[model samples]
Target: MPDRWDCVRENTEWVCKSTVVANTKEAIIILTAKEIGPEDSLAAYESHLKTPRMVPDAQGRPQKSVIKSVVSRKIAQHTWLDGLQLGSEIPSYYTRYLATVKSRLAILVTFSAHQRYFTKYSGDFFKAVNSLRIVANSDLLNPSATSSLELGGSEQIGPGQVPGFGSPLQVPDLDTLPSEPSGAPRNQQLLFLIGIIIAVAGIFIFLKRK
Candidate 1:
């Protein structure tokens, strides 16, 4: 008769073996089986229990006996490698996963951090992380970077460039433009006043005549 056994770890199934003693470790597993030769014998009482009568071979052993086995295991013990801790200081790969939630969720969680880091770095943090999502299989870290808005361009005036908005561009004021010299403009001013008086007198005369 052949013996069968199974190995399991955590919630995952590991391997199945026959006639082997198996040992599992954090990073590796070992399996061993003894190949009983035909001449290997059990106690006489133990052999008597078998359906067929068994005789010891020339070496005074069992007539036939053999064992075969196999071993299989995972390459890594834990999902994370490099001995890094989880939570606040999680790995980059894991962070990318977190970003893949809805855009609102991403903003709720990553917006402040993104602003703080990118303000100093001057590069699009979400864009870089989104690019990483193309390779990282985890969807939890893939985030949309579309909410960012562009302020303005060269031709269009920016808020900072507008008047009273800290713009260095100097705009000439209408009230500051030069006026004709006051002394030399006296005759012209008198003529302008006389013309207004004559026009008013003509209007009164025309109304009386009507």
Candidate 2:
């Protein structure tokens, strides 16, 4: 995974965006680790999971929306990961959040176009995330498990150093996928080339006649 440097990126957010190419479809996942206060995640998640309550619009009429349940698990000693399945309108995709124990770090991971790809690659996805580590120990972040990044140059970059972390999961096997264009850019280019060739031929004939 490569870290993207842009205006939106900030010191608190360690965001890495990856494009996954599969046999049938293309998808993207954005991994974010943001610094937060100790134990801030639970409160935030509870607030988001609040029951469906109606608030009035300008017309004083009430507007309502469905509220979904939140699911969670302990990823490490104190570290945790939470997931909330979305509404029927957006089935097949869920929102997820993670907090590292004692490190005051929060992680956000989302899978897009999930309905189209999850069934085929769920195994690989889970297996890959297991490689995620959240400890500060350099020894555990061994060279064998580390991967090289192209953020600046060719130097290798390991996972962020938190307090305690390790996993049986490995880096995802991201299959290379060719992106598709909305239209045939190749055909358009071919037509442009033919037009130029015809123009050149006409010019050559005109000059010869002259």
Cα lDDT computed for each candidate against the true fold? 0.19, 0.32
Question: Model 2: per-residue lDDT, tens digit, 84-182?
Answer: 332211222322333232233334443332334444444333433343444332221111211211111112111111101122112243333213223
Candidate 2 lands at a TM-score of 0.40
As a whole number from 0 to 100, the lDDT of residue 43 in candidate 1 is 28
Cα displacement (angstroms), candidate 2, residue 85, comes to 2.1
Q: Write the per-residue lDDT of candidate 1 for residues 71-98, one digit (tens) a residue.
A: 1211112110011101111111011111
Q: What is the lDDT of residue 99 in candidate 2?
A: 27
Worst 10 residues of 2 by lDDT: 148-157
Q: What are the runs in model 1 whose C-alpha is more than 4 Å off?
A: 1-98, 101-118, 122-127, 134-210
lDDT score of residue 63 within candidate 2: 47
RMSD of each: 45.6, 22.6
- The alpha-carbon deviation from the true structure for residue 41 of candidate 2, after best TM-score superposition, in angstroms, is 2.9
